[model samples]
Target: MAETTVAEVMAELATLEDPRTREVNEKHGDDHGVNLGKLRAVAKRLKTQQDLARKLWDTDQTAARLLAILICRPKAFDRDELDAMLRAARTPKVHDWLVNYVVKKTLHAEELRQVWSADPDPVVASASWALTTERVAKKPAGLDLAGLLDVIEAEMKAAPDRLQWAMNHCLAQIGIEHAEHRARAIGIGERLEVLKDYPTPPNCTSPFAPTWITEMVRRQQVE
Candidate 1:
């Protein structure tokens, strides 16, 4: 198969854009509406997809950028390159896609987590906490669980919105996945009271750590 140029890949993405999805996503502040399945189809077709992925990410359109996250070579990125991508991501959804899809898969995740978690930039900090949250969810060995709890306890309330969300997520993961840390995670959640009152959609557990942990534990008991 012939290598597809970035321009050709972008045109393909434009062809896949869904007007209704775009409208719905735009209401939530994201600009593009390409279907995920369609994007994956496009990913499956391109040769040297990472080259196209880099250019697409630079476009910063949400749908194209999401495709970029899906296709980009994690190994191609140094910490600086990853940091730049995190810094360039303007919206929460984009930041999240990059963290979950790109950063989480990278070898530099721990290194990035340590550096970005302490950065003053909220986006960078959010990405760090996000990576850490995923790490906890997967029950990785030798994590500084105590140190993480300390940070959450100390700064969750005062952290920026996106960063606070990711920190709460980390706390929840620890509670849900790490039996030894569950009690302290709940304690931290109770003390911090992060997202305690956020309205939950019907049939969805609250994302607040204490409630989330309690509800999951209850479900496990019944099951």
Candidate 2:
């Protein structure tokens, strides 16, 4: 596909303003019926249009939540709110868990670190998602590597098989990002046997590479 630009995305978003598109989308409002792939595209596009994303997150909380669960919606929310949600979460399956995950992927390194430092959830396991937990699977750098290690270790002790898949997903993204730093990066060198040669989503951009970060995500697919 040719490169998708912010303006192109805006054109599509503008369509949402159209009564027909909105009617179609609204008609498909059943949580399962909503086009998650389209929403992921919305999230990916939002990565570039921060101002527009902020307005969406602030002005339409329900729409934002909808985008998050179906689209990685929280990436565009205010940083303060993102951090607060992470630190204050009582359970991994809280109402806004997906929002926090999207935000984790979208945050700057320092801001992401603050989230890791403050995050309290000990272990997270999601069969469907890679790791929607705050700072574990998404943040690029400046995280408490040691603390993350502890959490993963604890997770392994608690349930090795399940957490191992999440670990694999995490390592895959890391490998794709800092190809140069793979040597010094903790666990980057260590192979998570379960995750070894984990398949990259053929249809979606590889999650590890910033270069591959795009204005759309193929959510209809499963890697």
Give per-model CA RMSD: 2.5, 11.5
The whole-model lDDT of each prediction reads: 0.83, 0.42
Which is the leading candidate under TM-score? 1
Q: Please, what are the lDDT tens digits per residue for candidate 2 over residues 1-223?
A: 4654435544555554445444564543322222445656777655544444444444333344344334334455566765554443332333234434554355542444444433344332332224333343455355544444445444533444434545444444443444443333334324323333445776654433222221122221233
lDDT of 1 by residue, 64-121 (tens): 7887887788788887998888888876678888888788877888899889977988
Alpha-carbon shift of residue 45 in model 1 (angstroms): 3.8
TM-score of 2: 0.35
Cα deviation at 97, candidate 1, in Å, is 1.9
Q: Which candidate is the best by lDDT?
A: 1
Quote model 1's TM-score.
0.85
lDDT at position 175, candidate 2: 36
State each candidate's clash count.
0, 1
The segments of candidate 1 whose C-alpha lies over 4 angstroms from its true place after superposition are 219-223
Model 2's lDDT to the true fold? 0.42
